[model samples]
Target chain A: MAPKTAPSSGTSNSFQSLLKSYIETTSSRLKLIDVFLLFLMLSGIIQFAYCILVTNFPFNAFLAGFGSCVGQFVLTASLRSQVNPANRAEFKDVSPERAFADFALGSIVLHFFVYNFLG
Target chain B: MNLVLRLSSALLAAAVVHAASLSIQNPQFKITAPDASQLRSESLSLAEKPEALSLGPSDVLKLTFQVVESEERKGVQPHQTFLRFYDEATGEEGVQPVRVTPGGKAKFELNMARPPTSLPPTTSDPLKVSLILGSSTHSPVQYELFDLYVPASQPPPAHPDEVAFAPRPEITHTFRPEQRIPAKAVSAFFALFVFWPWIVLLGFWFEIGPRVPHLFSPHILPFTASLAAFEILLFWYWVDLHLGQILLYGGILAVPTALAGKQALAKTSEWRLGRK
Candidate 1:
């Protein structure tokens, strides 16, 4: 078990290579979604930190600020997976047009709620 | 004649149900102590029908609510808690918002501008106070999802002219809860934050949920950590709602978070800008 680096490191390196390939091959749209998701998640963190420091004096405001980002991330992820022609095979019954429409509808509804709750 | 009677009865039943659901109890009202330093009466008191309240311009009014016990009311996260003061006689109204925090009670202090002279002497209606609950007014939409298992005895609602609909109210505002915030708005936030990815998992179960391991994902883990940290900080604030101490403590947390945020952004920029 000791001398040969056959078991643990071999699989780990292969996994890394696979992930790198996956990320590299990912479309610009999907990558852009990933970046946007990253932005939203980080914004949520910033709000969270601000909340911890300043206090959530305006609870509705805090919820709206944070909730919008989280909600968008979900919507965007749905858009990404559905818009990808690759996942089309998996979701055979669903059309990408329908998926995009759902995404749009969800965003409008989520933002409407967020805007209302915003202090 | 039998069909008309059945339709009328159905309409009446629906109206009754709607009315029962919408009714609200009259609020318990009192005036706060004129002195700035005093606390309100420790034992909760509800004022009876006073012909008139002897209130000066400087006097403050107090409104109190018992925390509701029902699950529906339990987590009523207040959106904006405010007092709507209306003097019927003077026909002047004022709004003062008092934000509700996480306490087992609801209390508000409202300063009067001047005694509302417009109110009728015989009428006991003081300035009206409205407690606006959650800002979002989303009632669950009902869809006929294969309306299964209907009894054959059940009759359909009548055609348009068969049932007489009442004239709509001039102002169509839902009854806003006085104390607790409605759970409708914020609970969605909670669900979205905590369990939404699993919802995605539900659809694409083959490649998601356990397979991809979203829990440990970098994008997700940070927000979860943030929520936990924020919640702990909130708990501290709740124990003693001291703004000064909270700001001080918040400053202490912000420094490290600011640094982490900068670093995270740096890496994220690299990813976004095609560095990786």
Candidate 2:
């Protein structure tokens, strides 16, 4: 147990350093997008857990909630990848402004379908 | 014409001779038990009926008679000999043919153990029995014999589809139970918990503080406003607006949004290139 705790604490220390470096190194614009992505993923996981732990009687509302989270997460993730400076070589044809436009369009379409199922 | 007139006259003479009335002679009835012991014995009068005869479940009733000419007392076979049993209360009747020998003697046996199918549906009331004899050469004769009190017959069998015509039992319906909501405390807890992501998002965004210098610019603001309008329109669609209205409004809104998006993206591309 003593040896196991030593390795576990070391891993957590390294994880904390990694997080600090990421916060310091990444651009604020990318962090903003990452925060929104984190929000979407957390919201999606909560909704899914609620469905599994509790009742899904109003299944359509659950579907709208969960589907919107997943759909928006996908669109936001793609936007993040396209606008990321490190991935500029991979997405040279997709500019940050174009990616934002695509995200806005995809979000509107996703919201339309989500609202359709909200009943 | 003369031969036809002679034939017609001869037929009229034969009809007047053949009009002699017929009668029954020595009509008798005997009811015996299954073991051949006599239960009842009587002679039926041609002018006056005998006492009503009763038969048990396994009784055998034997009736013997002879059809004869009333004036000559000569036996004559009838072309049609029938025994009629009638129920006056229910108006139900059954005609059973009695086989007559060529010498005018007729014997009919009613075995209670195996009653004839020709018996009508019966009750406790007595049935009026009558004998009828008809001959082509002699005039017809009918005589009321006597009443018979047999055991009441079993009721008629019900038709296979009889229940279909009867009033049916009431129909009942079962329905699924209504959906229920979770406890208010649980619901409120989940509702508040669900909004934690919003806190995380806002708190992190505040911490990161990304700059958006051209967000409110003429080239970018119109595009942002149109996108926001699309969201508001969708919310309105969820509240009350129908699909057709939403589609029409969205189509009209799309044109301006496309124009504004092209202008905004083009300007942003120029800025990006200039910074590079």
lDDT of 2 at A97: 87
Task: Return the top candidate by DockQ.
Answer: 2
Deviation of model 1 at A51, angstroms: 2.1
Q: Which candidate number maximizes TM-score?
A: 2
> What's the distance in Å from true for residue B65, model 2?
7.2
After superposition, which runs of candidate 2 have C-alpha atoms over 4 Å from their true positions? Answer: B1-163
The digit string of per-residue lDDT tens for model 2 on A1-119 reads: 99999999999999999999998999998899899999999999998888888767689999999999999989999999999999999997988988998898899999999999996
lDDT of 2 by residue, B1-276 (tens): 999999988997898677788888889999999999998888888788888898888899999998888888888788999999998988888899999887789999999899998888789988899998888777787899999988999876778999999999999898888887788887778878999999999999999888899999999999999998999999999999999999999999999999999999999999999999
The total number of steric clashes, by the backbone 3 Å criterion, in model 2 comes to: 0
**Where does candidate 1 stray beyond 4 Å?**
A1-19, B1-276
The docking category that best describes candidate 2 is medium
